[model samples]
Target: MASITSSGLGSGLNVNDIISQLMEIESQPLTKLQDKAKEAQAKISAIGTLQGALSTFQGRVLSLSSASAYKSLKGSLADTTIGTVSTAVNAQAGSYSLAVTQLAQAHKLKSQSFSSVNAPVGTGSMTIQFGTYDDKGTSGNAADDTFEVNGDKGALTIEIDSTNNTLTGLRDAINAKKAGVTATIVNDGSGYRLLLSSSDSGKANSLKITTDDADGNDTDTAGLSRFSYDPLGTKNLTQTQAAQNAEFQLDGIAISKSSNTVTDVLQGVTLTLQKVSARDTNNAPVATSLNISRDTSGVKTAVEDFVKSYNEFVKSVEGLSFYNKDDNSAGLLNGDYVIRSMQSSIRSTLNQGLGSGSYYQSLGAVGVSFDDKGNMTLDSTKLQKALDTRPEDVASLFAVNGVTSDARVSYVSSTAATQVGSFGVSISSPATRGNFSGLAVANGPITIAEGDNDMLMVAVDGASSGQIKLSPGSYATPAALAAEIQSKINGDSRLKDANAAVTVSYNATSGKFEMSSNKYGAKSNVQITATGSATEATLGFKVAQGGTGSDVVGTINGEPAKGDGQVLTGSGKAEGLKLTITGDTAGEYGTIGFSRGFASKLDQTVTSMLSDNGLLRSRIDGLNRDLKNIGAQGNTVTRRLEDIEKRYRAQFTALDVQIATMNSTSTYLSQQLSMLNNLASGNKK
Candidate 1:
C-alpha cells in the first residue's frame, strides 16, 4: 500500500485546523507593533494641528509690530465741495484755514480753421519747446510777452514729410512721439482745426512752437509755419487757455503750487483743489476749515484681534493636551513636552517688560494681561483711556520702537540683534556737502552776450551735464547772476536723468559765486568742466574742482560704528541700531533708548517654535523615526511568524502519518492471529 501524503488523511485527524490555530497565537507581537505605529501617526497629526494654531497666532501678532500701524491720521474738510483732503502717517494733528483762489489750468492752443481734416500741409521740421512766458504788461497778450525755454523740458523736433503732411497724419505722428504735448483734431463751426495742449499745468510749462517751414517763410501764416507760436517773434496759433498755478491760502498765508494736487506745502497732508473757493458779499475768499486728528480705529481693531487670537490659541492648546481623570481618557498629545514648552515660552515673552524708563513698559500697562486660565484678557475701558492719554506710548508697548533725547539724532531703524537699552551717540566728524567757490567778479551788472559767455558745462556728484545755454541778458547784481546759473545747471537733461542738482549762491561779502551739490557723502562733488570764451571775464567762472563731501564718522555705545552719508549704525551689543545724525556739531549728541514690545518679541518666539529645527519639528522627526523602526521590526516579526506556521504544519503532518502507519500494522497482526486460531481448531476436530 502507498503511504498517505495528504495531511490528516492517514489517521483521520484535522491537521490543517490545528496549524492555523497555532499560527494565530504566534502573531500577537506583530499586532502590538502595528498598534504602536498607529499611535505614533496620531501623535504626528496632533502636532501638525498645534503648529497650525501657532502660525495663525503669529500672523495676528505681526499686525501690531510695525510702526506704521500707530501713525495713522484722519483728515476732514468743512467744505467738501471745494476739494478732498488725504493724510499720511507723518501728518501732524492740527486745524488749518484754507481758501482756494484759483485751480491750475494747462496751456491749450488751436490752429486756424482748415477746409478739411485731410487737407495737405507743406512738409517741414517743427521744433517744440516748453518754457515760461514773462508777460511784461497784459497776461494773455502775446505781443507783450517774452518766452524763455526750459532746459529741463528738453526740446523735441519732429519731421513732417509727404507721408505725414496732412492734418490727421500730423496728429498721429506727433502723438507717436509722446513729446509731453497731446495733439487732437476738433471740428469748429467754420472748419476742422488741430488742438495742442501742454501736459503740465503751470506758468513755467507753457509751450513755444517754432518751425523751419519748407515754404521759405518760417514765420508766415502758411504751410507748417502756421503752427508756430513764439511770443517774442511769430504768433500763428491761437491761445485758448493759459497755463496757471493753483493759488491757495493756508492760515492767512499765501501758497502757490503748479498742480491742483498740492503735497509739499504741508508736512504730510495732500490737498486736492477742485474748484475756486466761494466768495462772500464783500468779494473776499471764503475759508474752509481742515481738521487733522489721530485715527485710533485701526489700532483698536488690531489690539482686539490680537487678544481674540491669543485666547483662541490658548484654548486650542488646552484641548490638544486635555486629560479626563474620571475615565482615564487622554488626548493624542496629552503628555507632549514640546507643546507645553512652546506655550510656556510664549507666555513668558508676553509678561516681560520692554525696557527701563519706557512709557507703558509692558502689555499690562496698556490693559492687556493673561488671565488665570492662560487666556489673554483686555480691559476696554483702560485701553481707551491709555489711547486717549498716551497713544504713542501704547504703540510702543506693542511694537519695536526707539526714542532719542536730542532732536538732531533721529532713530531710523533697528533689528532683532539690537538689545533693549540706552546707548550713547558721539560724533567724531560731521558730514559736509561738496561745494565750489568761483573767483570774484571784476564788476557788477555783468553782460552775458550771445555767442560769448552763454554756454557752461559742469559735473555734479560724478554726473556730467551737456552744454547749458544762458539767456542773453544783463544781470544787475551777483545774486541775479547766481540765480540764472543755478536754474540752467539744474535744468540740464543729463544731470536731471542722473538725479543730480546744484544750488548756486552769491556770497556778498566775498564778492564771488558759490555752487554746491545737493547730495551728501563721499560721492558728492561739484566741478566746472568747461566754459565759453568770455565766461571767466563776465562771471569769474573757470575750469576748477570743488571739495568732496565726506561720510559722518561716529561711535555708538562707546564702540566703533559704521557711517554712510547721514546714517550712523551701531556695533557690539547695539548692532543694527541706526540713527540719522543731522547736527553739525562733533561732540556727544545724546543717548538712544531702544525697546522691543510684546508683539514683536512674541512674533519671534512663535516663528522659532514653528521652524524646521524647532522643538515641535524635532519631536515629530523623532516620532517618524520610531514609526520607521517599528515597521522594520514588524516586517522581521512577520517573516518569523510565517516560518513558525510552516514548522507547525510539518510537525502535525508527520504525527498524522505515524499514527496512520501504526493503525495499519495493528490490522495486519489481528488478521494473522485469527487465521492461526481457526487452523488449530480444525486440526483438533
Candidate 2:
C-alpha cells in the first residue's frame, strides 16, 4: 500500500476540478451569445416582411395608374396632313399607323364560256364563267354561240342576244369567271346593244371566244337569237386602258390621275377608283354615263366619301373602351380607341409649323374626339372653317413631317437623313470592362416599322450580366433592310462594334439582343436604355421621350444569361415609355441598336469583406477545429486526473489501515510485556 501526497494540489484545489470549472464558464457565455443572435435575426426578418408587403402594394397601384384606358386623345388636322382625318390624337405615340388612302385592288377579268373545251357541232349546253379563266377573259357560251349566228366559215345553234346583253349581268358573269378580267356593258338606247367590256384595261383584259357550228360547221352560226350576228365581229370591244380615273379635291383644289391608285396627289391621302357595281335601290345601273372619267362631280364624290369614312372611324374608336376607370381594368373604348386612332391618324395631315410644336398642341382644335358612344367623331364644319380661315394653320395641324405626306411615311429623303436602312451601334458594358460584343452578339439586320412604338432591344454584355436598350427605328421595306443588315454592320465597324471586340447579329423578326462571351474574367454586367423614332434628333418630329433609365432589373451576376432580359408579350417592350418626335421634313431616321458582349472578370467580392482565405464558412470551420482541440486537451487532462485520483484514494485507505494496525499491534505488545513484567515481579516477590 502507498500513501498519497498533498503536494500535487495547489491552494487545496484539484487540477481536474479547476479544468472542469473553466469549461463550464466558457460554455455558458457561448450559449447566451447564440440566443441573442437568434433574437436579433427575428427582429431583422420582421422588418423585411413589412417592406416586402409595401413594395407589392405600391407596385400594384402604380400599374393601375399606367393603364391605356385612362387617357384621352386630342389633336387637329391641317394642310400639312393627308387622309380624311380632321384631326388625330397622341394615343398611340409609340405605335404604327397604316391609312390605306389607296390600296392595290385585284383586276377584274370577265368573259362568256362553253360547256366543253371543244364546242363540237352546236349540240352542247352553253356555260358562261364570267370574270376570268385560264388567262383568257371570255368563258361560257360565246355571244355568237349562245344563239344561232352565221359566220363566213360556219353556223351554230347558240348565240348571245347581243342587243339585250346587260352590263350588270355581264359584269357578274365575268366576275364569276375569275378570268382576271372585269366586264360590263354601257347603253344609252341608240339602237346599239351588247357592249362587251373587261375589268382590266389594256391587253391584259382581252376577250377571246370559241365557236363551232352544228353539222361540222367551222363557225357557230345558230347562236344569234338575241344578237345581230355580224360576220365582221363588230360587237367585240377591245380592252384598252380603262377610263376609270382617280380624282379628288384638297381644300377645293381638284386633282386627277389616270390610274385608280394615285400617290403623292394630296399631302397624305391616296385615292383609289372603284366603279359602282350595284345601282341604287332601283336595281339598275347608275343612269349616269359609265363615267370612268374624272370630273368635278368625281371630285365632289371623293370629298363626300372621305368625310363619311372619317366620321365612321371616329365613331368606332369612341365606342371601344380600353380601360374601365371605375373597375381599374379596361374602359369603354379602352383598348380599341388607341388602335382606331393609330389607323385613322397614320396618314392624317400634320401642321405646317408643327415643327415649332408648341402651337400644334392637339387634334381637338381640328375636331376629333371620343364621343359618348366611345366612337371617334369629326366636326366637318369646324374642319372646313379651319381649312378656310387658317389654311396654313390647318396645314400645320395635319401635316408636319414634310411638304408632302409621302415624306413622313417613308424615310428616304436625303443621304443625310438618318439613313433608314440597316444601322448598327454598340453600347459599352459597365460591369466587366471587357468587350462582350465580340463573343456573344449575333450578326444583325433587324426590320423597323414605318411608324413608331416598334422597339429594338440592345444588349451590352452577355457573359455574367447584360444591359438592355430600347430603340425604335424604321425602314422603307423590311425585306430590303434585312438583306443589307449584316453588310452595314460589317462595313461600319466603329458604329457596329466596340474596339473590334464584339460580333453583331440582329433578329429582324424578334428585334431583340443576343450576346456571347469572348473575354475571360469574373465581374460582368450590362446597362439598358430606350430610344424611339420620335427621339432621333434628326427626325424633327415633336418628339418627347421617357423610359431611358426605368430598367431596374439585371441578371447573370455569376451565372449564364441567354438574353434573358426579354420583354413580356402583351406588355409591349416600349409600352411603359412615352415618345413624341417632330418628324424630319428632310426625312425621319428610325432608331436601331447594337449588342456588345463581355466575358467574366475575377470576382472576389464574396470573400472581400473577410480574409481572402477565410470566408464565414472557413471561420466557422476553424472554430469547430479549435473546439475539437480544446475538447481533446480537456478530455486528456480529465482522464489523467481520474487515474491520479483513483490511485491516491486507494493509497490513502491502505495507509490509514496500516497505521491503525500498527497502533493495535503496539497496544497488544505493550499489554503482553506489562503482564510478563508483572509475572516476573510476582515471582521475584
Candidate 3:
C-alpha cells in the first residue's frame, strides 16, 4: 500500500548528502588508479616515440657505412655530344682521352619496290644468316665474312605460305618469330618496299636472308627469291647499310671492338660509342677526354647527414630526460640507465681510433667534432682539403682496409671478423690435387675414337659423382688431345653441376701426360675405369690406384687453421683470417691487417640497438607490462568503489528507517500522557 521512500525522506537528516560525502572520500583509490594508468600509457607512448627516432637515426647512419658509399665515382666527358659515360663504385678515377674513329653499325637491306603491301610475292622457306658486308656494292668472299650461327638460339628459319605471302603478312610473321632481325614495310610515294635490318649492333651480327620459293625459281626477281641476299652469289636485296666494328682510341692506343658497348677493354669501365669523333683542322680526330673522379659529394652529404642525425637524436634524448623548470616535473624517461648507456656507447664509437696504421684514425682527425652543447659539427674546408689531398686517407678514416705484410697474403673480410688488429699467416705444406700420369709420347697427332677406343671414367666428390666420356676425334698433337679431354670433362653437365673439374696437360720436353682434378682435399679423388679396349695402359691412365687430393696445411698466428683447397681460414684469436697459399713458405709469410673503421663500428652499434632484442625493445616491453598492471589496478579500484557506494546507501537507508520509528514512538508516548492528564482533571472536578 506504500511507495518506496528515499534514503533521507523520513529522518529529515539529509542522509543522501552525507552518503555522497562519504563516497567521495572512498573514491580516492580510484583516482590514484586512473592517474597511474595515464602515467603508464604516457610511458608506453614515449617509448614508441623513442623507437621511431632511433630507427630513423640508425637508417641515416647506415647511409654512410658501406664501401659503395665511399667508392662513388663520377665519369664526365669533355664533349658529351660524342658519347655519354657511366661509372660504378669500383671504377678507377682517371682521365681517359677517347677518339671514336667509328661507331658500330648493324646491316640493313631493302627489297625492290612492289605495287602494294597486300601483293603476294610467292610462298617459300627463308633462311636468315648473319655476316659482314662491304660498302663497295660488289659481292665479297662469303666464307671470310660469313658468321657461324649457334644452333640453339642464334639461327632461326621462318616459313612463308599462301597465308603469309603478302608484304604485311611477312612483316607480322617475322615480328612474331622474334628472330634476330626485324622487318618493316616502307611505303614510298610510288610504291611499297620491304626493309630488313639486324636487331643487334656489330659486324658479326649482320643479316643475310636466302629464300627457296615453291616455284623453284630463285633467279626470278619477282618471286620470294627476291628477298635472297648472298654477297658472293645472288643479290636481290640491296644493301643499304653495311655492318662494321666500333673503332676507337683510348689514350692514343688504337682499340677495335665488335660492339659499341665495350666492357672487356677497360677494367671496371664500359665505353659506349655514340658517334664518330669530330676532326680538327689537321684532319686528326678531336679526342673527347673523360674525367673520372671520386664523387666526394656523397661523402660530404653523408658527413652532414651524420651530424644532423646525431644532433637531432641527441636533442630527442635530452628532451625525454629533461626536468621541467616551471612545474618542477621530471620527464617520463628521466635518469634511465639505458639512455645513459646508449649515449656513452655512441660517443665511444665516435671517439675510438681505427688502429689500422692509418694517418687519420678518429672522426676528429677528419674534421668531425662534438661541441659543448653535444651537437656534432663538421669543418667543410678541412674535410674538402683532406679529400682532395689524400682522398684514400679520408676513405680509410671511415672504411677499414685489410692490409697484408706481404703482397702474397691478404685479408678478404672487413667486418665479419670481430678480432681486430694484425694476425700472422704461416704456410707449411702447399695445396695439391689428385691426378693420373700418362705414358711419355711424341707431340704428334693422337687418335681418340668411339667403340673399341672409347675412354670412360668416373669423377668422385663427396656424394656427388659423374661420368667422363670422350668422343671420337682426331687431335693433331698430344696437347690437342689433352685439351680435348679437358673440354670433355668440363662439358659434362653432372660434373659441372657438382663443381668437379679435370685439368689435362701434356709435356713435350718431359714426354709426360698429366690429368689432374681441379679440386683439392681428401674428399676429392678421380678414378679411371677401362671401357672397351680403352684400358689404363692404352689411354695412359692409372686405373687401379688414382692420385689422392690433399688439403693445404697452414697455421694462423701459430694456431691450427682449416684448409679447403688453396684457401686457408683461421678461427678463435685469428677468426675470419683467410689467405691463399698455393705453395709452401718456410715461416710467417705475412700479417693480415684487421681494423674496424668508424662507419663499421657505428653500423654494428646501431644494428644492435635496433634489433628485436635491443635495449629500446626491452624498454618498450617493460612499459607494456606496467600498462597491463595499471589496467588491472584500475579494474580493482572500480569494483572496490562500487562495493563502497552500495554499502554507504544501505547504511543511510537503515538510519532513516530507525529515525522514523523513534519519531513514531515519541508521538505515541506524548498522546498517552495527555489522555492521562485530562482524565485526572475530570475526576477532581
Candidate 4:
C-alpha cells in the first residue's frame, strides 16, 4: 500500500525527481558491483567451455593410445562372390589359397504326411536324443556327454506327452523347450507333416527320437511311437538333409569344421562360407585368394581425429586466455598463470620425441606437424606412405605394443611395471579352472519324492557362498529340473558378495550331477553340502573328481612372480607389473615389451590436466570461488543501497510537508491583512 503524496506540489519544486537523481548517484557502487559480478559469471562460464574442449581432446588422445587402433587388420577376398572374411587385431599380414568344398548344414528330418495338422499322434512319451550316427547300423550316443542343462552343460532330453499329442501342439512344446532341435509343421501337397531340424550345424548334433506308447507296445499305430525316428531302427522320419561338416583346403592343407563359419581354422581369421568355390573350366575347384593386411586407413583416421581435437582445444584456450591488442582488453582467463603453465607443459610434452632408437621417433616423422599458430596439421600422403613402407615404425610412433614373438607364448595385460621397457615371461604351469562331479548314477535321472527338499550349499575359491534348493520331482526323463537348481544358486542375492558362481550340469553319459565354479585358480573350488532333510551321502553329492583349480606358474623379468588363475604378477624388478596369459600355452616362455608412444604420453598428460587436482579443474574451482565472493559482495552493496534509498525518501517527504505548512501559514497571514486593509478603505470612504 503506497501513499499518494505529491512532495513537490507544496514546495513548488520536483522533490521526487530530485531524490531519484540523488539515489542514482548513491547507487554508483552498486553498478560497479553488478559489473564485477557479470565479469565473474562470464569467467566461470568460459572455464566450463574450456573444460569441455579439454575433455574432448583427452578422449581423442585415448582413442589413439589404444593398441587396437594401431593393430587393426583387414581381410580381402579375391572373389567377393565366393565369401567374405574378417580378421582380428592380432592377425598377421599374409595370403592364403582357400578352396571351400562344402557348406555346413543342420540335420533336417521330416515325418510322414498326415491327414491334418491337428490330427492326434497319440498319448505316451517321446525321448529325443542328440548324437552322430554311422553306416554300421549301430547307433552311438555321444551328444549326451556335451549337452547343457540350464547353466549346466551335458546331454539333454525332451519329453512329449498326451497334452501335446497333436502335431501343432508338439511343435509348440518342442519350441518352448529350447532344446537342440527346432520343430515346425510343413504342409506338403499331399498333407501336413512335422519337420524337426537340429539347431546347431554340427555332425555331433544329429537328432534321434524314440517313443514309448501308453499301451507298452512298440507297434501302436496311434501312439507317439508313430513319430519315432531311428537311423538303424524305426524310420518314420526320413532325413531330408544330411548332418555333415564343412570341409575345405587351406594352402593345400585339409581342414574341416562343423559350421560354415570357420574361426579356429586360421589364426585370428573368421571365414564365412557363402558357397563352395566355383568350378573352373577343368572341373577343378577354383582357389580363392584370401589376403590379410594391416588396416592403414584406420590408423590414419585416428591420427586425423587427434589433430582435429587438438586444434579445437587450442582454439578454446586461446579464445579464453588471449589478450586483444586492438581493443586493449584481456580475455576471460587473461594473465592466469595456471593456464599459461598448462599451455607450456602441453607444448613441451609434444616437443619431446619418443621411439628413441626407432627410425620414426616423433610426430613430425609420422607427418603430424604444428603450425606457427599452434594448430596441428596432417600430411595424409606422407603418413600413408610411412604406414605402407614401415608400418611397424609408424605404429611405434604412437604406441609400441609388446609383441608376443614366440609362437607358443601369448601376452595378456601389463601393469605395475614400466610401460616402455621389455620383460621376460616364463610359464611353468598354465592356469586351469576347477571342475567337480558328484557320484555317477545309473542311466535315468535320480528322482526325489514330494516334500523331499534338498539344500545344496556351495563355496567358490573361498569367496562366494550360495545355497540351492532342489524340489521334489521326477527328473529321470526330462532334464529341465537340473536347470532350476542352477538358477537358484546363480540368482541368489547372498552369493553375489563372493564374486563367483557355481554351474550345475547333469552329465548324461556319466549319470552324475556336476558342479563347477566360475573362476580359475588354485583356490577356486565349488564345495557342496546337502543339508536339512537331505544328506550328501544319500543325495550322492560326493565329489567323484576335480576339486581344486591350478594357478598359473610363471616368472617375469627373471624375478619370481605370483600367478592368480591366468594372471601373472611380477615382484621386485617387475614390481607394479602384471600380465594375463591366455590359451593353452603352458611351459612356454617369451619376452614381452611395453612402450608408451607419443600418443600415450600425450594422453596421460591431458588426463592429468583434466583430473580433480589438475590445472584446469583447479582454475575452474578458483573461478567458482571468485564468483561466489562476487555474489556476496553484490548482496552487501544492494543492502546498503536499499538503506540509503529509504533514508533519502524519508528526509524528502519531511521537507515537502514543512514547506507546504509554511505556504499555508503565509496564505492565512496575507488573507487576514487584506481583510484589515479593506475595512480601513471602507471607513475612509
Candidate 5:
C-alpha cells in the first residue's frame, strides 16, 4: 500500500499562504483594540469640558453674593466710578473763594527822568560817570571812555584820554583783566565803536554811573576824577523787577514760584493765579477737593457679567447629571468621573468664607439657586433680602481685597503679595506724569532754612528782559538805547558768532516780549538761571538771552509755554530740558495720552495679550487636529472592519467549499475501498 506523507494536500494553496491569511485575521483584532482606545480617550476628554463653564458660573454667582454683602452694609451695591471727569461746570460769580497766592510784576509807566543840567565841573560830593564797558570798570578813548554826573560838587568830565592821557592808559591797560563791565566792539557801517549797557536785565539791569575802575574813588586816573560829560542826556526809568522770586503758600504747602502758576505738584493738577483782584470775593473762582461725582453704572455691568457666567456653569453641571429622554436616553457624561469632580468644584465658587463684617456672607443668602437640571436661577426678591441683611459682608466678598490674578484671581490668592505703593504703579498701564514749568524758585544757589534738610532756590532763569539798559548819560530814553543796541546787534557780523540776536517781540495781551523763535529746530535751546535774592524789595533781574520780543510767553520757568489765558501748556521743567510736551496737561479734568515713552511697557503688555493668541490658538488648533485624526482613524477603522468582515466571509466560504469537497472525496474513497475489499472477499471465496 502507498504511504500518505505529511505533504499530501489535495492540490490547493501551500501552508505559507494560509499562515499569511491567519496573520491578516489576527491584525484585525489589534486594529479594533486601537480604535476602541481612541474612543475611550475622546470620551475622557469630553468629560472635563465643564471645568471652564463651571469657573464662569462661580464668577457670576459670586456677584450675587457680593451684592448681598453690600446691601447689608451702609454702602450701596451700586457704587461706581466716573473717569476723565467731564461735567465739572465752572462755578458762577457767587460760588468760589479767591485768594492771591503770590505775584510780582514790573508795572510799566510812561514817564521821563530828571531833566539834566551839568557843565564839565560842579560841587556835589558824588560824580556820575559813563563809558562803562561790558567787562571792566571804565575807559577813556572816544571809543572806550567815561563821563561823570556829580552828586557832590556837581562836577563832570569828558576825558577822551585828554586828562593826563592817563585815561587812555586806563582803558587800554585793563581790557584783559576781565573784572567787571568792559568794552565790547561791534562794527556797523560807521567804523568799530563801543557801547555801555548792563550785562543783565530788569532793575539790576543798569549802569551805576560812578568815578572808579576797581576799588578807587577819584584816587587814580582810572577813576572818574579824570572824566567828562555830554551836555544833553536823559534816560527812561522803567518799572522793572527788583527780585526774581515769587512765593506764597498753597494750603500752606509753601510754594515758591518764578512765574504765575505751578504745575504737576499733584498728579494732573495745575494751579493758576490771575493776579489777585482788588475786590476779591467768593464770586471769583478758587478750588478745593470736597466735590464728589455722581454716576455709578460700572457697578451694574460688573455684577451682571458675574451672574451670567455663574448661571452658565450651573446649567453645565445639571446637563451632565441627567439623562436625555430621547435617542437612547443617553447622557453624554454618563459614567464620567471627571463630570462629578467638576460638579463638586463649581459648588465651591459661590461659597467664599465670611469675615466679621455685618452684611450678606454667603451666596445662599442671595437669590441664587441651582435646579435639579443644575441651571442657576435669579431670585431678585431673595437677593434684595440678603442685601438688606449683611451688606458689608457682601462688599467684602467682591470689593477687590486681593488679586483675582494680578488685578483679579490666582492660584494662592489668599496669600498673594500685598501691593505697597507710593505712586500709581499700574504695570498693566502706563505710569502717567506731567512736566512742570513756570518758575519753581528757591532761596539761593540754595537756601538753608533752619532744621530742614532741603533748601529753596527760587531764582527764575527763564525771564524776558523786563527793562532796557540806560547809562551812557547821553541817550534820551531807554527805548532809544534799546533801539540803538538792537540796531547795532542787527547790523553786526559778530552777533551771529555770539549766537545772539536782539529782536523786539510784542504781545497785545500782556504787552511784552512774550514770544521768540530761533533757527527752526534745536537752535532754540538755552540755559537760564537767576542770580539774586528775594526779600521785601523790588524783585531781581528777569533776563533771557536766546529768547527775544514781547512775543515771549509768561512761562512757569524758561521751559517755554502757551498760556490758554488761564492754564499754561507745553515745554516744562523736569529731566533738565526745555521740552515741548504736546498735550493739554492743565485741563480741568485729568486726561491721559497714550505716550510711547511712559506707556511702553503697557503697550508691550497689550501686545503681550495679543501675543497669547498665537500660542493658545496653536494649542487649540493642535487639539482640533488631534480630534480630527482620531475621528478620521475611527472612520477608517469602522470602514476597514466592514471590509474585513466581507473579506473574512469570502475566505470562510472558500474554506467551506474546500472542506466539503475533501469530505466528499474521503467518503467516496472509503466506499471504493470497502467495495474493493468486498470484491476481493467474493473472488477469494
Candidate 6:
C-alpha cells in the first residue's frame, strides 16, 4: 500500500501560515506609502476649506473700497403725505419749506363719437408732432391756438392703408410704433370714441396730429382727416386735458418745472409731487418742512460686517493648523507655510497707513483694531465720532482715493497701474468745440417761408442730419432766429439717434449766427452741408464747413498724456490716472494726491492668494503630484511582494517534500532492519 501524506503534515509545519506572515512583513514599505498618500489627500481637503473661508471674507472687504458707500445721504419730511424726497451724494444738509400748488399733467384728446370700435376711418398717412400750445390770446376756442414744435422731440410719420383703416386697426398700428402717444377706444354710453394721450407729463410734450386723407380732403371731418388735430387748421379732436407744468413754492420763492418730479431746482435733491398742498383759511398753499441730513448707519454696518467676517476667518485659519498637545494629535496642515504667509500678508496690509493726506490715515484712526488673539474689534462710539467730524477723511482711509487742489481739475478715476503719489497737472491747450459761423442778416426780422427756406442738411460731431425742416415763422431778433435754427437742428432724427446735438448762438460782436456742437473734442464739429433755394437769402447761411475742434494738450507728472473729449489720461508713473480739465485757461492747474487704502490693499492680497496660480493652488498641485508618486511606488512594491510570496511558498513546499521523503526512507530502512533482526533471532533459536 502506498502511503499518502500532506506536505505540511509530513514536515509538521503550516506552510500557508508561514507564507502569509512573511508576505505581511515584506509589504511594510507599501503600507507606509499608502498612509502618506492619505495624509496628502487630507491636507488638500484642508486647503480647500481654507480657500472657501478666505473667499467669504474677501466679499466684506470689497464693500469698503469705494467712496460712494460712505457718501450716503438721508432725507426726511415732516409731513410724508405732501410728497416724497430723495437725495444724492452731493446733496447739502439743510431744511426747506415746500408748497406744491400743481402737479404736471399730460395732454389727452378724444375723437368724435363713433358707432363701434371697428368703425371705418379711411386713411392715407398721418404725421404726429410734439409741441407746446399757447392759448394766451384765445378764449375757449380751439381754432385760435398757437402750437410751437418742441425741438427735443422729433416728428414721427405713420402710414395708414386699407389694412388698418378701422378704429381698432389704427389703434394697434399707433401702439406698435411706440411714438410717444398711446391710443385706445372708449365707450361713453352713447358711442365708442378713439382716445389719445401723451406719454410724458410736461407742457412741451403735447401732441398735434396732421393727416393727408386718401379722399383728397384733409381738413374736412371725413375719412382719416377726422383724426387731424392741427391747431392752425383742422380741429376734429377735442382736448379733454391739456399738458401743464408743475408749480410749487420753495423757501417762499415760486418755482415751476415741466415735470412733477423736480431735480434741477435743488442741488442733488429730487422731489416727487404726489398731491397739491392743503389750502389755509385765506386760500394760500400750506407749507411742509423737508430736512436733509447725512446718513451714517450704512458705514457703521459695513465696518461691523467686516470685523465679524475677519475674526471668523482668523478662527478658521487657527483651527486648520491646530495641534493637540494633550492628545498627541496633529491637524491636517499643522505646519503649513502658505497658510501662515496668507494671514501675515493680510495683517500687514491692515496695519499699514494710508498716505492720502486725509484726517484719518489708518483703520485704527476710525476705531478698528486687532486684539492680542488676532481677532478684529470695532469701537462703535469712536467710529461714530470720526464719521461725524471727518467723514470724508474716514472714507479716504478705506478706499482708493484721489484729491485735486483745483476744483476744475477733478479726479475722474484711476486704475491699479496708477501709482500712489502727487502728480503735477499742466494744460498747454484747452479743449474747443467745433462751430459754423453764418453770414450776417441784411436787416431785422427774418421771414422763414414754407418750402423756400425751411429745409437744410447739417452735420454735428461728424454725424449727418438728413433733410431737417425748419418751422415757418417770423423772427424778431437774431436770438430768436438762433433759437429756431437750434431747435430745427437738434430735432433731426438722424442727429438725435447718433447722440449728437448743437447749440446755436448769435455773436453780437461778429454780427453772425454761430452753431456749435455740444461735444468738446477733436471730432466735435457742425457743418451745413446743403440748403434750400432761399436759405442763403433769408437766413444768410450758405453751404459751408465749420471749424474743426481740437483735442486738449496736457502733461501729467512731466510726461505727455493722452486727451479725449474732456478727459486726460496720464502715462509713465501716473499711468491710468484720468483727470477732467474743465477750465478754459491754459496753465498749471495743481497736483493730484492719490493713495490706496487698507481695504483696497487687503482685497488685492486675498485675491492673489485665491487665484488659479495662487498659493493654495500651487500647494495642492504639489501634494497631488506626491500622491501620484506614492501610488506608483505602491504599485511597484505590490508587484515585488507577489514575486516574494511566490518564492517563499515554493521554498517552504520543497522543504516539506524533502522532509517527507526522508522520513519515509528512514521508516522503510528501519522496518527492513527489524525484519532481518527477527529472522536472525529465529535462526538462533
Q: How far does residue 239 in candidate 4 sit from its true spot (Å)?
A: 1.4
- The lowest-lDDT stretch of 10 consecutive residues in candidate 6 is 1-10
lDDT of 2 by residue, 345-415 (tens): 33232221222322334455756444564444566666555544434333333322111122112111121
Better of 4 and 6 by TM-score: 6
lDDT of 5 by residue, 12-90 (tens): 4363466457657756755775665565555545444544554354344444332222322111111121101112111
Using TM-score as the measure, the top candidate is 6
lDDT (0-100) at residue 315 of candidate 3? Answer: 85
Candidate 6 lDDT tens digits, 406-467: 87897888898988777899999988888778887754677788799988898888899888
Q: Which residue pairs in model 4 clash with each other?
A: 147-154, 148-153, 148-154, 415-577, 416-576, 416-577, 417-576, 417-577, 445-476, 464-498
What are the models' TM-scores?
0.87, 0.20, 0.72, 0.73, 0.31, 0.92
lDDT of 1 at 354: 77
Native RMSD of candidate 6 (Å): 3.0
Model 2 local distance difference test score? 0.31
Total clashing pairs for each candidate: 0, 154, 0, 10, 91, 0
Rank list by TM-score:
6, 1, 4, 3, 5, 2
Tens digits of per-residue lDDT for model 4 on 339-403? 78889888888887553324566788878998988899999998888987866556657763555
Better of 1 and 5 by TM-score: 1
TM-score of candidate 3 on Cα atoms, chains taken together: 0.72
lDDT scores in order: 0.84, 0.31, 0.73, 0.72, 0.34, 0.84
The residue ranges of model 4 lying beyond 4 angstroms of the native Cα positions read: 1-5, 123-132, 136-154, 212-214, 217-222, 341-345, 348-362, 385-421, 433-520, 523-547, 555-562, 569-578, 582-588, 595-624, 649-685
Q: What lDDT tens digits, residue by residue, belong to model 3 across residues 378-432?
A: 9988888787776655666766555566756745553275466667788787677
lDDT of 5: 0.34
Give RMSD (Å) of candidate 3 vs. truth.
7.5
Error of 4 at 58 (Å): 3.8
Residue 147 lDDT, candidate 5, scale 0-100: 26
